[model samples]
Target chain A: MSDHHEDLPPFCHPVSTKLLFGVFFGLIGLTILTVATSALGSALGMPPAFAFPLAMVIATMKAFLVCAFFMHMWWDKSFNVLAFLSSLLFVSLFIGMTMIDTGEYQPTIEAFDINNLANVEVSE
Target chain B: MAVADSHNTHDDHHDLYDHGEFIAHHFDSAEQQFDSGKLGIWLFLVTEVLFFSGLFVAYTLYRTNHPEVFEQAHVFLNKYLGGLNTIVLLFSSLTMALGVRAAQLGRNKNCSVYILITMVCATMFLGVKAVEYSHKWDMGILVRSAFDLTYTHPTPTTEIGKSLHISDYLVYLCVVPALLLAGFLVASVISKLVNKATLAKFMMAMTITVSGYFLGVVIGIIFMNATEGETGSTHASVIVEQPLMLMASTQDDHAADGDHEDGDHDHDKAAAGSSHDGEHADHEEHFGSHPADGGEASFDAHHPDPSTLSRDVGIFFSIYYCMTGLHAIHIIAGIIALAWVYWRCLLGHWRTDYFGPVDYVGLYWHLVDLIWIYLFPLLYLID
Candidate 1:
């Protein structure tokens, strides 16, 4: 699974400078794309439902490139990769379960906002 | 790639005993020591991810609950500055990865050079963050309980109009870097005079890294001025009073005063314009509008009252600071750790069998970059 160089150490997985710069430029390009997508998406009246997720997906792609290449995960042990992915799984679970209960109190926030707006008009 | 010739230097490459001091006796071989440390770093990263996940959870919850707050407050965040920082961090991550590769090949010179570049990037990141944070604070964008987005400080009544200048904020940010720069110069000179080549070289690298803060400050100010040229120094008071003047002209007072007709016209368009900026750059008739600016950013034209539109924006900034602030702290910590690696690299402590420190630190640095990948889009490019 690893590159076996007689002179090189077992844990060492030296990356090519070309690949490093390639990832760097790729990240910069994706950054510009993201900014453009957000700008163009709203200008074209794309809904948040679509626009937000689209941005997140791009961010995830960039994150993957950083981990797999810059962090040398592609040559890393499987055990380490599993540990990292599981942490993300737990994060998703944590955010998901907490989110389900939030819907119940959402109306209270809307009610307060409406009540406050009424006061502003009356004062003016 | 430059290390492809490392095999030719095999004769000079130190044997395993040279790396013995770095590896603890508990480890049987250099390979075993490296494996244990690598595993340990990955575990630490898992915990770091979970720690940041808590903040991400807060962000998602609030954003879902009150989307309007995010949409309104996010406009105040200058995406240009954020984008610059993102580029800086990504570039740093590249240098850090190269440094690790250099260390693995036992090229201390290349490794130190790369680590130094990474350090400069870290400081530059903080310098930009300082500009962003202080600018928001001056505008009274703060956490809940202290949130007052509408606090428009009267422009400093001086010929210089120095108050709220982005440069003024930058000076505060540059204080430590400037002192460090001076100290480094002095130390470098003294070390060289004392025939301490190693210490002199180390100090020189540090001087260059600190200078990066000054570089960032310059970029930060240039960006701030470009975005809201009307908000710097002398022009600031004009923007502060722009909204009130715009409000008064709505009563159909046009042409009543022929002398003021030209100035009034500019205000009319600025106040009426879709996003609240009408640049009559050619006309400077002591424009009735203090500075046809700062009726404020990307405001909703449909909702005339700013306070109402800014409702719950504090919640958004609160989360913004918490997430980005913690991330900045990590960057600072990374710099501290990089300083150690820089010292060790200069001492030529890393060889093919003992580059664990560089590798571990590079992993940590990449995590910082990873968080910012999510932050730039989520915070600056809010839908």
Candidate 2:
């Protein structure tokens, strides 16, 4: 033991309890908001399809709060953040490509796969 | 900590601060080890994101193809239960983050408390999922082929909870955990009798946390019943509540639909032909009369969409089970990880510079929460 006991370095930064509580309550509020807006949208006779994008947007915001504060990406190394964010980039790429591919085959699908309750095959 | 330091071999070099007892020999400094671990965990998280993306892609594909299916199928999912789970996961994420913070400050006891809270939430999540899955199975809501949307829990043929019914599966799933919970309670009391205070406390924490599963089961059943009142888990009830289920159905489309099948399995539709309303005995006579009907005249005004009324509606359930099932798997994996971290915390392994396990596991727990964030909205809240 040395004459003076130097503290261990803060490699993992300790976030304040106050800030943590703030972020947590913020998340709860956002969740309530998302559900409320969805219920409101349906009540107003707005197309239910529009609710999808709205819910996605709210979820993205919640995700941002979670990643930035809860996951500690805000104070983390830029490279680590880059690595995590890149996966999302690739996910969007994959889904986007599939959408494009499915779009190309829409005409062919429409030719045969009409909404017929009678011929609906048991796909289990 | 003293026992751990005895195993440490890095004392050969002179350093300003002493590395913790748990620091690996490969790393020169504690900072290097922590940083390396941080980077590795982030990379693993990256892979996790990519792993779940496949299911998301499948979800998007199906949702885009047959939107009406999603609209009809999602009603079967109890939104109240989904919302409860979302809140539970989010709360657990907060406690996990707090635990990491406590570990950073070297407050092992406080950290363990937070870890216990997180574990309780995780178990509760699985319990609620159990209720949802079993209820769906009882309604014959399976994947594409066996997609029978009838809510009929007939007479129990067995003395034991072992039966072909999916609800019986819940009884089976509860067996192991219930036994484990009993074991933990006994061990906790025994440890206290032996004057092992810490061991007693640890076992007590396990006991309480395991019991959270039962708590979740109770809550899920009650909340589900409250929300599903009057209708009582009936697919017909959900379709009836949604007034616009037949909004897209036009008179000409009915005639156009007539040209679909010369003679197919329309009369032989599983749940539609033989369902809760057992009086509709003559399937062929029933369907030969009205092509645009909701199969039964009683169901026509109530059933929302014609396509939704079909058994192919199981496609949505297929995707639903896959996504949420995968997420549940991750939660179970996370509970194991949290248990490891909690064990290390009990050993007082986390120092200011050596708290890698807590942080890494916190990241993982947060990722699980993030996925559920998307899942709840996508699966339950279909407006």
Candidate 3:
């Protein structure tokens, strides 16, 4: 190992200094972009639904940069990448199921609120 | 498979087991050990994601059901502070990545420096979080009993009112531990001076004393909760007070103008009631005096309707505290991990051939940053 100091293992892909700096600045720029876009979206009176998804898109991009370069997941093992990405898939499923349930109850909830108001008025 | 096997055989001469000193005997090779550890950390990160996913689910459900509540409550959060924390965590992630790189290059000094910087950023992040939490506490916008609802209604039988008053004496909880630790340290020094104790004995005593103090705190909290339960004081009874007045005051001057006719009637009634109760809720006078703080100012400037302050808004704050509190716990863990790796780097434990610890810690730190990346916009930049 001492004699072959110049030889790196086939798996070891050390990122270049220039690339690390580039990623760092890129992250900072994206941070500013997220804030600017959100602020701009609000100022322009964009709907919350549209503004939120746009902001999330920027956040997803930032997260990808961090995971790929900063975390070295890009050049690392495919199993690790799959392991991490699977969590997002599960998260989407969780969110989706909950959204479906909440949507189903929306009308019932609204009716309940109106019923409660009528009861309050009658009691008063 | 055959081509890969041939390539492996071609590089067989370069396969050095000199990593034997650092590599566990159970592993076939250095690469195998590193890969196994990397896999383990990735799996752990997966668990971390799921752990926080539950909170995200709650956030999504609540925001979906009550968008107005989130919009109004989120106004209390300082976006500049949140943005600053986001940048700090991002920089820490950069330093952590660089730290791992430095370790990979056998630059122990630079590795330690980067790790130290990462730890500093973690501390700054926690400091900012503390400021935000304390501000929330002062504004009576906390979870459950932590909120100072007694400011407008001083119910004598309410457990939260009693608990809120006790917070003034929470400083005393620190006294016992400080005294215990100090007494042990002083006694240890005296024993050493008199040659009655070895250095090892003194060090053990100090450790035992610190652990004892923490144990005391845990036992104390358990006892408090048990006694509170015995008294049949349900946690939910401590409802938010001055809700209407606070909500009305939170509206913008212009918005209030349009609703002035009706708002004035409710405002006068609520204000009169609150002031009358305020005279008796002297314990809450500290928070009551600061009605025009930055949070309120911002709330007035970008006011949501008073209707947004329905009781459900407390759920928004409750979710906020839980998510951010859990995230802060992760930040503390990352800080401890970085500090440990930094200490090891200073002792020359990591080098070009065995930088797995630095790499793993860097991965953990990046995950922490990743969580904050989503949390910031979701909680603070709500449209």
CAPRI classification of candidate 3: acceptable
Candidate 1 residue pairs that clash? B238-B290
What are the per-residue Cα lDDT tens digits for candidate 2 across B153-192? 4343444443333257567667878998999999999999
lDDT over C-alpha atoms for residue B225 of model 1: 66
Model 1: per-residue Cα lDDT over B1-383, one tens digit each = 12323233234443334335566756655777888999999999999999999999989887875675676567677888898899999999999999999998888889999999999998888877877876777666677535544334334444333643443444565677889999999999999999999999989989988888877776776777686564534224333433322222122232322223234345533334212222322111122222222112213333433223332465677789999999988998998899899999989998777899999999999999999999998999986
Candidate 1 regions off by >4 Å?
A1-5, A104-124, B1-19, B151-168, B233-311
Q: How many Å off is the CA of A69 in candidate 3?
A: 0.6
| True-vs-predicted CA distance for residue A93, candidate 3, Å | 0.7
Off by over 4 Å in 3: A1-6, A103-124, B1-19, B144-309
lDDT of 3 by residue, B211-286 (tens): 4434433333344344222212322111131133333322223332234323334455334433334233432233
Q: Flag the better candidate by DockQ, 2 or 3.
A: 2
Note the B-chain TM-score for every model: 0.74, 0.76, 0.61
Clash totals for all models, in order? 1, 4, 0
TM-score of each: 0.78, 0.79, 0.68
Best DockQ among the predictions, by candidate number: 2
Worst 10 residues of 1 chain A by lDDT: A106-115
**What is the Å distance of residue B179 in model 2 from its true position?**
2.3
DockQ versus reference, model 3: 0.35
